[model samples]
Target: MGGGCCGTLVAVHLLRQHHPAHIDMIDERIPGRGLAYSTAWDDHLLNVPAVRMSVFGSEPMHFLEWLRTHGRPDASPDCFAPRKVFGSYLQDVLNDAVRAAAGTCRFRHHYSRAARLTYDGRVARIALVDGERIQADKVVLATGNPAPFSLEPAVPGCFHSPWEPGALTGFDPDADMLLVGAGLTAVDAFLALQAQGHRGVVHCVSRRGKLPHVHTLYRTLPDSFDAAGTGGARGLLRAIRLRARAAEREGYDWRAVVDSLRPVTNDIWCGLERCEQRRILRHLKTWWDIHRHRMAPEIGARVGAAVASGRLVVHAGRLMGVEPDGSRLRVGITLRSQAPLSLSVERMINCTGSDENYRRSANPLLRSLLESGRIRVGAIGRGLETDRHGALMESDGTASGWLFTLGPPRVGGLFETTAVPEIRKQAEALASYLFSIVREPEDVPVDYFLAAGI
Candidate 1:
């Protein structure tokens, strides 16, 4: 029910497939732009290059071609363009598809948040926050990542998520601040603050004070590891380490070894038992993320400079306590094998990234669905449970006939579903399946579900 990149990509595929039916997208923000792409800061560059970030999987060079024609004439395939440009590209792609399907298909965008959803026999009814109701034969929950975890005490100076509009505003230029993570999100926050002329020292604290690795040109290695054949997480980790060492001995970068696993990561993840998966998430998820999701070279350089200059402090610690001071906040932290340390900061920003645990999500739509047993939490409590084809699974272990999802919501089933490469393939396959299911345009009627009682 989102109008973000996932939803937009799905709509584009449906239109391109010539689905002669009505399609509706619901979101309060600008269509084709979600939390990740809504940023206007140029320093928030895409971690992936233009060539690998296409909305259409079949058209690998689509984004690169678009960049070249749209004000980036000198853009190369490996160029990591500003994220805002990609947002505009998505908008243009949606617009082009809409124009192409002008007479054959009907499309509408609802500028509202989805509050509830109900399915009765054949039709699915979606209730909007503005009291609007719409019915369709199928509904796809393309809602991207959930918000960051809400910290306790609800202090005034604490920003729970840096993606919120004006989240970095209202802070003094010379006031020291603290970031509650040391991942890619934290790096983005630091860059945004720097762009805003925030000259105060920024303290970044996390369980492991390690930032994402930098991207570099490396040789593409052939597949040498059998991820599916690997016994478990430990076996997979050991194999990767061995392969990385071998590659290093051969004068190849370990990054290439990691990159080579892209095709088999999901296979390995799915092959593991739930307990094994839990073990990986508990101990190795952070390490995998730092390597899998890297920073742009330019971004890495800036962050390195900041760290070298001591303006950015990295603490491998956990936040012990936070109490409000008169004009600021007093934060307590405990580093590994170190004594307790305290700091007073003017602001604290939560950059821990998206909270994938849907069980604790406070979104009205998800709450409604969970309460009604329309959808269940995924294995290991990571994301929503979905079948291989992206169909949602109900509380009773039955796959939903009409409800489906893609992107971040399918994380538990497909560990690597969030990236553009994976999501584009999903959108395409889901669109084809949807097309096959509802072969005739008249299969879906215009009547709303009276049982919904909206």
Candidate 2:
């Protein structure tokens, strides 16, 4: 359904593996250009290095190799490529796959939003907003990230998502602006404002007021910690801290220690009890995110300079209130261990990252599925519940045979589901699973319909 990187990866794998008879992608945005990669700002470089960004995990150097032959002759594996370039790479990969399977596989893209979905045991039918309906043997919800949760007592001039096409437009260049959430999203908004010639002071507020760490040249270390031996969340934290310190003492960066856990993160996450998983989300998620999802070195340097110049201010606090003040907004916050503070700003944008709470999702298709008891919320309400193969779990706790998803939709079950490295593997495995059960070409009737987004 989606035409983003995740959906593109799945489609490519499906075509290459079995040349499925027919596949339809549903999305309004151009294929492969999801919110992350469609940015107009060239400053928005990918957080992961080129070497690790391949859509095919088995071909780890595919993306880097593609860059060298396509425009960037001097590209290196360690360099951080602009997300815009990555988007193009994904589009090219899908295009080539479609061309190669032209005779065997039929492909189409519906440039519209999926409004509703229904299944009658054997076939899944999707209703589009444009009064069109399609039936498919299988459906994959690859709708990337959802919009950020809306704030209560909504006020004018408050944008819930910075990725919206014109979210930052029309703001006064000299008026102060506030960004809610000081994670990677906030970093992106800050850099975007700079690129847009905004000279106003930008304030970022979050519970921890922590910024993402910067990437550095470091060798990946081999796995040494015993996750199974670690009893619970606290023990896991203690073990990681001890390992990080040991690595530092051994003249290696802590990043090496963190990277070493990549291969086994899902195993460790799934091994924990539900309560233990909740504990990690409540206490350690923010800290883990800052360290694990770092900014490119160049972006880090720019952010550091902004902080030094005092144009960007970070606060550890909770939003107290927000009220309109004529042409601006009066925002109140209770700073951590400090007195309450108030600021008047021309705009406020939500950069808290994606809203993983599918129960409250504004997407009509998800809403319909929830209301009809076709899907249930996942662990800790992070995302929809799914089995190991990304099959949606119905309200009664049985995995659906025809409804499936990947990438962000699988986050609750697969802790490391969003990145290309993890998602590509999922796509490949998912394609293989579908291929194993697919009918012969003569009997295939719309093999799958991919609904991309809200």
Candidate 3:
């Protein structure tokens, strides 16, 4: 019950295929922009190239074609356009799908938040924050990423999420600002501030202080890479290193080797045991993220320039504490293999990115479902438990035919579910599965409908 990219794309797929039913899309924010693309900053470009960002798997150049039609004749497959443009494109596609549905199918947009969900062996009931309830034969939970983790004893002049409107507003352009993470979100925050003419030092601290790798134009890997043969995390690392060395010998960049892993990442991840997954998360997740989730070339250049010019300082440390310091905040940090240090900053922003733990989520709907035992947390304690087809699993270990999910909610089951490439594929597959299971209202048990008290 979301209207972001995942929800919109799934809806488009279902509508285009003529799903004969009424679809209710719900979200408190705009349907297409979601949290990631709602920004007004033009400096924020997509991480992936345009050619690879299509919503349809069969048409890889769909996004490029859309760009060309929208006054961007010079746009090529490799160009990384502003994220807002992509958001606009998504809106256009959703509009077209809605128009195509005509009288055969109905699409409704609900500008509200989902508060709770309940199932009674047949139909599902969804309650909204406005005290309205809706019943459906099937439910798809596309609720996207959760908010950033909050620190205890909320400190003034500190922000937990940078994506909120006006979160970075009203700050002095010349005042030093501290960022709590050095990943893509941190990079986005740095660029957003720079775009606003912020000239003060941007101090970024993380466990490794490692930024995402820069994108490069390179050829794809050879067909003999054998990514599936890697036994576990250690074996995968060794194999990638070997491939990187061989690619260097052939005068090719190592990026091609990493990109080659994209098609088989889920396979490799599924082959590993739960302990192996935890090991990767503890030791190699950061390194893998930096390489796998590289930034756009242009954004990377700006970040490099900022660091080289002493305007951005990145440190490898852990945040010990943050206390009030009269007019500013005193941030305590402990660097690896070094003594603790303290810095007073005018403001601190938590660019630490999404919190994957569902148990700790503040969303009422998710908490309700978890507490009611309607859905069980994943084995890794990161997201909801789901089968291969995105069907949610109940606490008693049975797949829920009435409930499904995609995107970040399936990260624990599918290691690479967040990106566009993987998500679009999931959308298409889900739409196909739902279409196969379409049934008449009479086919569903009347008792199931009455169980929701609708």
Span of 10 residues, lowest total lDDT, candidate 1: 445-454
Q: What TM-score fits each model?
A: 0.97, 0.96, 0.96
Tell me the spans in candidate 2 whose CA falls farther than 4 Å from its real position: 441-454
* Regions of model 1 farther than 4 Å from truth: 439-443, 446-454
The residue-by-residue lDDT of candidate 1 on 1-454, one tens digit each, is 9989899989989989876767889999888899789888999999998989989877899999999999999999889999989999999999999899988887889899998899888788888899998887889998899888887756878888887666687689999999999999999999999999999999999998898999998877877455655687788898889889999998889998998889888888887899999989998999999999999999999999999999999999989889999999999999876879899999888999889999899888898898899999997898999998899999999998889999998986878999889989999899898878773644545354243222
| Global lDDT of each candidate | 0.88, 0.87, 0.86
Which residue runs does candidate 3 get wrong by more than 4 Å?
444-454
RMSD to native for every prediction? 2.3, 2.9, 2.3
lDDT of 2 by residue, 48-132 (tens): 9999999987889999999999899999889999999999999999999999998888888889878888987767888888887
Can you write out model 3's per-residue Cα lDDT over 296-352, one digit (the tens) per residue? 999999999999999999999999998899978899999976879788888889998
- Between candidates 1 and 3, which one is better according to TM-score? 1
Clashes of each: 0, 5, 0
Q: Which candidate number maximizes TM-score?
A: 1
Q: Is candidate 1 or candidate 2 better by TM-score?
A: 1
Q: How many pairs in model 1 have backbone atoms within 3 A of each other, for residues 3 or more apart or on separate chains, i.e. clashes?
A: 0
Ranked by lDDT, the better of candidates 2 and 3 is 2
Work out how many backbone clashes candidate 2 has.
Answer: 5
In Å, residue 117's CA in model 2 sits off its true spot by 1.1
